[model samples]
Target chain A: MRKTQPYAFIMPSLLLTLALGVYPILWALRYMFYDYPGYGSATYVGLDNFARLMRDAEYWNSVKNTFIYAGGKLVLTLPLSLILAVILNKAFRGRQLLRAIYFLPTIISASVMSIVFFIIFNAYNGMANQFLMKYHLISSPINWLGADYAMLTTILIAVWGGVGNYMLLFLAGLQGIPNDLYEAASLDGANAAQKLFKITIPMLGPVLQMIVMYAITVALKGYESIMVFTGGGPYGKTDVMYLYVFKQFFPISADTASMQRFGYGSAVGFASAIIVGVVTALYFYFSRKMDKIY
Target chain B: MTSAKILTLVPRTILWLFLLLTAFLMLFPVALTVLGSFKTNLEVTVGATILPKVWQFGNYSTAWKAANFSRFTWNSTFVSAATTVGTLLVTTMAAYAVDRANFFGKRFYVVLQASMLFISIGAVVLRPQFDMMIGLGLQKSLWGVIIILISAHASIFFMLIGFFRGIPRDLDEAALIDGCNFYSVFWRIVLPLLRPALAVCGLFVFRGAWNEYILPLVFTMTRPELQTLTVGLAGLRYSIGSASETQLMLAGACLSILPMLVVYIFANKSFMQVSAGAVKG
Candidate 1:
């Protein structure tokens, strides 16, 4: 009776998972092999979708864009967040206020943030370009949303919105460290540089790993900002894989020629899923290995 | 001693400087947006000014009307509240069962939870789920979106359960000895002890539902009246064409964020504690 009662308690969640989670994945898998419009008659086209994805130029472009975006975010945001975390970890007046201010963006809606950034980075009347020209930092306002700078601008916005949350994560990790370790290092006459190198970084390994994994996952799934700010515009310069998949399903252009190939889009979705899955798996493997060592 | 002190001071100073610069960069967009919200359209287009020459308080009222802010706010509140309460109830019961019960498929449950964590957003699976919902006659409904939110958040609920397991079993035993049944013991004893975890879990579920975009965007397509704050904001941003209208849109954006800002300010300390507890556990 005791055991059976527990099963009853868990049954609701299990049923929900089956209904909403497991069944959906299975349905997608089934649909992948079929020639189905989003809302039309379906026919099996076994392997045709997969075969076309192998040679799709747009799909490959999306793959390249995903890598660049993810790489850019990891390189720019991670180090900056780490540095900020270290500084905020120190004793200072008004540190909490600063921390709250820094973390403000994380709590806001991404779509809203994207809109705010779009206005600030607007080509003709943006504050960024106006400030630059006012100070003679530029001869004229650079077109930040143009093809030449769109992806980089998108990256900057992403990093700015992201750094605060990661900083807080790292701050929490830093707080968990024993103060006595720092005292002991000070007794040994270690300079701040030595203390950071010898003690702080090593102690923060687990937190760093967690942050990196999160950053990579978020970067790989980067879509909302692109969707709102650039709409993968200016010759598809900012088009990442997720946006490409979204476009394939809901093409903005009304021309039949420009209409998305849902069959091919599913293939793209599957491929992106595979890439993210592999990366996440590798992250877990490495983290687990490191855990054993530590 | 003097050389060592100098070297230590230099690195600390440099680190502080670097942090201050980064913090400025991070805070700039938010600060600028707030400034933009208060500016007239003409001032907004003219240049970057720290303070608006003409502060337009009416823009807030205009934005609220333009976006149909009341409808979106109500929809978001209802959906988010439902999700939070449903998730807490379902997750706590499920977690209790997984942790305390001697079940036959416990390992399977564990694997399911772990896989849910690692799987990406399951975007590929979205259409089929939509199809299934359509087949079941649930397309373009608020309830459909609520159900999706609950399902999507199950993994986090399981994580909270894992945290709950860290609490000792002796508490449960003592409660049982006081003549409480499993449900009573869970409600009276275990559930009360899980407040911190529940708060963190509730906040996550609330935030996720409140800020959710794509699912509601896709599922609630036919029903404009059913849109959440995120989709409403997206539409508002897209529709505003003129510079003045854009300034008005910024006001709308500020109005949308005002509730969350107020909540965060009031709950800042508890929010931090709950979030830290979730991660650390």
Candidate 2:
């Protein structure tokens, strides 16, 4: 129980974070200012790489793509998860079993899920199209992986993979609400809808904020599924910022001449970090303000 | 009374239908994969059959050899197990210290935990961390990947520290009154009491490490011998080539998911409860 002994307890994790977390961030910052690649000596570029990113069309496309993906996911998935959570929160028979079934996808690897979705969303010979056609919903299969729907396809898969985790989160929040609040609202002649709006939504503000923050962050970090399904392909229609960064560093082709853009890629990476950081900070500011208001 | 009864039945029926539909949507992809795992490449692509014409259990064996899945699974198991143990030990000690031991930097530690709640740039950190790993001569090794998993998981442990802190200090004091030292108090009293939190944190770390793809993909490039299941599965995707639909690869993918599915089914309640509690906290 010595005063200093406890420091020994915390030192291992703190040191690990310093080595693996803090050090790499610093290294990335340093690398951004230098022209470094997987090979060759790094040269100090002094923001030239960043300056070049201002004019790079692909970087801008990726920025636009990242925002589109993040926005689409937030708009679609957040409301869906909230609705699902609200529905599942009601007392019903077999609810626990249903909860487990819904949560199964979130526990599995995204790579595995992506592959499964690839099959389901395949242009032909996939079950999804077969079902649609069988039901006479459409004459032909939807081109899910084509340029027009590729990004949408990615977003749908992301939403499907993600909704379960957030639903559980909202379920917890719903459970935390005291029953007396609902009783009071009922006594005031509030309908169920009115009670949900006045009592539940207001009380669940913090959890909702947390969900939005987590969802936005996840949307911004959408790489794994895109990597597996499209490889940002069918002519880069599915390309997002993270995929662009990956391709820059680890180009899949044999042409080393086109692959030596480490400085520019690092610049792009830094730009992405800045955008994500800004978005996260803005979310916090708004949430904190909302917290004060609520 | 009769009108009320009718109203209740309508809502209950609708709720049941909604829940059933949602559950079906969630479970359909997994069911398809499991069903497809039993079919041949020809049967998989040429037809739209819910049940395979002939169940080919041999696909499992084929995928096992094709992807060197045994070695990949071994590598994944070693990394995940080591990371889990490392995370538990480090997080437990840190949580114990942060929660029980009032120290000079308690406020700073609290801020550190809160900051961890926002640290979601693990993918961005991978490249630079790889550079640092290379500089430190730990690149292209399973140990390096394990270290990365442990570090990336520090936030979860930090959050667990907060959870542990919420537990009453009276328990620790009672243990001390019985002549238990700090270690004994932590080992016997606090750790046992924190099982719910521990299980939550442990499973979260395990699943994160197990399902991780990009980190291993980037870091373990030189050592193909050290690839994890995620990376191994990605490689398998290409090996099956244009000739194969998802059904051909479904068997391999299902095999990959079996370990997780088994773990999830047994521990589903604990997993859900703990994770839900953690998020709410």
Candidate 3:
């Protein structure tokens, strides 16, 4: 009993994590190589699912879409959030209120918020178009949800949803930079842009690296909003990798032609996971190299 | 001196303008949602108006009924609460035991947790996870999602472990000397001391469970009645059975945000502090 006491304390979490967290991942690994339709017996189809994955156009398109989406989000969100964080970090009236308001979007459920966005961006009589048209920005409503602009629309919402969380993160990082650095920069007659580039950006290197890594993984994994917003619709133009794989398992979308293909999905999932893992590994490798260079 | 002062004032004015504009952009969608909730459908679709001609407070009740929000809210509350409690218990105890005791496979367990942190299989593993639930006979209810949510405690486990290390071993030893077992020491001494950590982490865990979309979305697919608020609210687009129940959806959106908003308002400091601390490690 004395020897087993520690095990007893850790057993519940150990068992649950093993069962739910670790097991499912191992389970996916095993299922990826089989011809399992989720109900019938899974036959050994060693590497066939992967072979098909290589040839799959839709899956490839999703990979492309994932890059575009993640890239768009990263490009927009990093700069925007950093700027917001910098501005909000200063002593000002209503700073807390402003920070909270910015952070508000981060806390809301993505799917629910995406539903609101769906309404706002609705091609006809939507708030966005209405607002734009009211100000005579355009004579007619742009089909924001149409295939031509759907990806851009989703990217905008993604940036909006994400900018705050990153801003808060930047704020945290900003707190670490000593005021003297900025004061010293001021004393040296550095302008705002110059200080931002030479002092702020360099000072935020490690934190920014982590944030960018985080942003990349999160952007890659994001599908909830898009799932709710477009259901990977308008000819699958907005279908990211996760949404595509999700369609394999849930097939909730009316447009998705395939039903639950567990084997192929597991394979696709394995591939997608590999892609994300590679991206993450490459980021770490490059960031470390940059560390050496700097 | 006057030119220098003017230069400083010019940038200051521009900064203020920029900050105010961003603040407006950030608040506009949320504020609009609130206003739209109280607006007539006709008013919402029509371009000119920002607020309802007459506030339709009844839209809340109408949406609440139409979206089955009460049931969904209850489900969300139950699942989130259960997940939070389970996560706290599991993480705290495990963290306490790991920090305090020398156990078999301890190194391996630590390595496993670390690997789990980095090796994210993501949504790909959902099918297998669901199948595992089916194997356990938990696939039919919200319990499966709750269990999955609880099991994804690697981050929390690590966080609690950090918090646990801050707690002195002398206290545990003293408790042990006072005729208390390890369990009682944890329950009576350390657990209470962990209130702050638990509260911050628990709020986040609750939020994650509440805002979670895909797991509940998939698990509750067969049972519409089991859907949580996020899933239910997302479904409002189609389920309202009209060309557009935009007002109703806006109402549901407001409702879904309320509980979290309240939590954020009260524990605003903790939320900010924890999130800031999270990145340091």
Candidate 4:
């Protein structure tokens, strides 16, 4: 075979990738320097989009919200799923059935999860309010998707919708550990907690890195659920980075934002992508370093 | 029983109980949605009943027709099928070339695929891509959505790459020595060996494309006729304004979820094994 044969084989995907992924990224970078109200009406306004973003309170708030959501999901999901995986790892009746049930959420469409969450947390007679009020946990039904509670509600739903997928990953990690390690630990008189900390965690270093990276990236980029559930608001409290960019193009309502700033939104998107890229790269680099140390 | 045995037994039983409760909590929301589809929205929201008092079977039909789910499903099927075929062809050739073909820029393709997984921010690209799609005359068409869906799913490489690496390179050489061209070697020998991986990757691509929201939503915004199941269901949520029609929404959600759920159950073990392997890899 010719040396270029491989190139020929890969050209289709590479071209598609270029068109879909790389071209858009470049287009975004170019759009950053312009004032694009809509197509074919762009004006050369170099650095203006960047200047606006520097002072744009709403954009910065969305950045802050992205971090909060991402950080919360990372902190909440990793340990939660790890513990669940550990519990499910034990020899018990109905373990397979339970495992399947836990994984069920991962299979459901994001729209469905969003809808269910929206209804459950609906201010009036929603199941969440009913459940909480039933237990006297709160004085009254809280409008969970309302401005005051939107971020919290959004984060919880993200966790609920996401945990099952990560739990299964953790479960796979647990199953990968050699039985002999646990046996040796048992011989050393290690308790369950000790075994978890010493054997399971140390063994799961790579998986932990993978999961953390996934959780952070997912949390940062997640918008569909929030869009469906809250529409990024009661105000703009629940707006994350991606949702902010998305709403820039497709505003919450037509009359409210008649002038869509396509150029500005693209600049924000480009900048956020850079931030995410750097953070993700930092995570990968440090995790690889951790691998070396271990 | 001895106190030692009883102590272990007691804790084991406690653990079992705790796990049982956690599992129930996990399943409760989804179960409620499925069950709620059978009842009026008032019963679902106003009361927390495990089962409907009188099962409302008409909700599914009402949702099915009202949401124009038949159109949605047809579009979804077209997009998903096209995506699956395109992805399989692209991934298989790409994987083969990367694994076997000792060509220039081999390293570049590998790195490119990896970066595709890492640096993904198509959110910003929405405008340009939309414009480009229009330029290409694919805007607001299933083909536009299908093309974009195929591009977005680089993760299908996860299973395929791993599987390709596992196959022996000697087979490729043997076919080459048999006077076979690269395509024949790939098609006749390497591709046959990839049957299992193909099955796993195909299902994943199909399912991902089926569930995809944003791409379809944007591409089909002007043409609701081209909207996928997810886009339709999302629209259905707002259209069912009053709580009286909430069951219709739930039933619609059920309809959207049913195909994937049924497929997952049937392909349960294969799916689990493939994901487990993919994650570990």
Q: Provide the TM-score of chain B versus the true chain B for each model in turn.
A: 0.90, 0.89, 0.94, 0.94
Ranking 2 against 3 by DockQ, winner: 3
The positional error of residue B92 in candidate 2, measured at the CA in angstroms, is 0.7
Q: Which candidate do you rate higher for TM-score, 2 or 4?
A: 4
State the lDDT of candidate 1 residue by residue for A94-130, as single tens digits. Answer: 7887788777777788887888888888998887887
- Candidate 1 regions exceeding 4 Å error are A252-260, A281-293, B1-13, B242-244
lDDT of the candidates, in the order given: 0.77, 0.78, 0.86, 0.80
TM-score per candidate: 0.92, 0.93, 0.96, 0.94
Tens digit of per-residue lDDT, candidate 2, span B1-281 = 69999988998788678877878888888887898889877666656677888888887887777558788889889888999988888878987888778899867765765665565433446767776777888885777888877875546765686678678988888879999988888889888888877777788888888888887887766678898888877776666673563554787688779898999999998678765875655
Writing each residue's lDDT as its tens digit, candidate 4 over B1-281 gives: 89999989998888778777867777888887889889987787887667899999988877777768888888888988999999899888888887776776778777877888877554677777887888999884788878877786568765788899889988878888989888899889988888988888888788788888887877777788888889988877666574667787788778878888898888865666666675777
Model 3, A144-242: lDDT tens per residue? Answer: 999899999999999988888899899999998999999998999998899899888888888888888988999998888999998887998999998
Clashes of 1: 0
Docking class of 4: medium
TM-score-better candidate, 1 vs 3: 3
Alpha carbon lDDT of residue A170, candidate 4?
Answer: 87
Question: Which of the two candidates, 1 or 2, achieves a greater DockQ against the reference?
Answer: 2
List runs of model 4 lying over 4 Å from the truth. Answer: A90-92, A131-139, A253-256, A282-289
Runs of candidate 2 exceeding 4 Å displacement: A187-189, A253-260, A287-289, B1-11, B119-124, B177-179, B245-248
Model 4 lDDT tens row, A1-294: 477787888888889888987798888878889898875688989998999999988888889988888888777878878888898888877878877777777777786678877778889878888778777899888988877888888887777777777888888888878899989989989999999998888888787777778877877888888778887677678778788888777664432375677888888887888888888889898788546535
TM-score of chain B of 2: 0.89
Pairs that clash in candidate 2: none
The model with the greater lDDT, 2 or 4, is 4
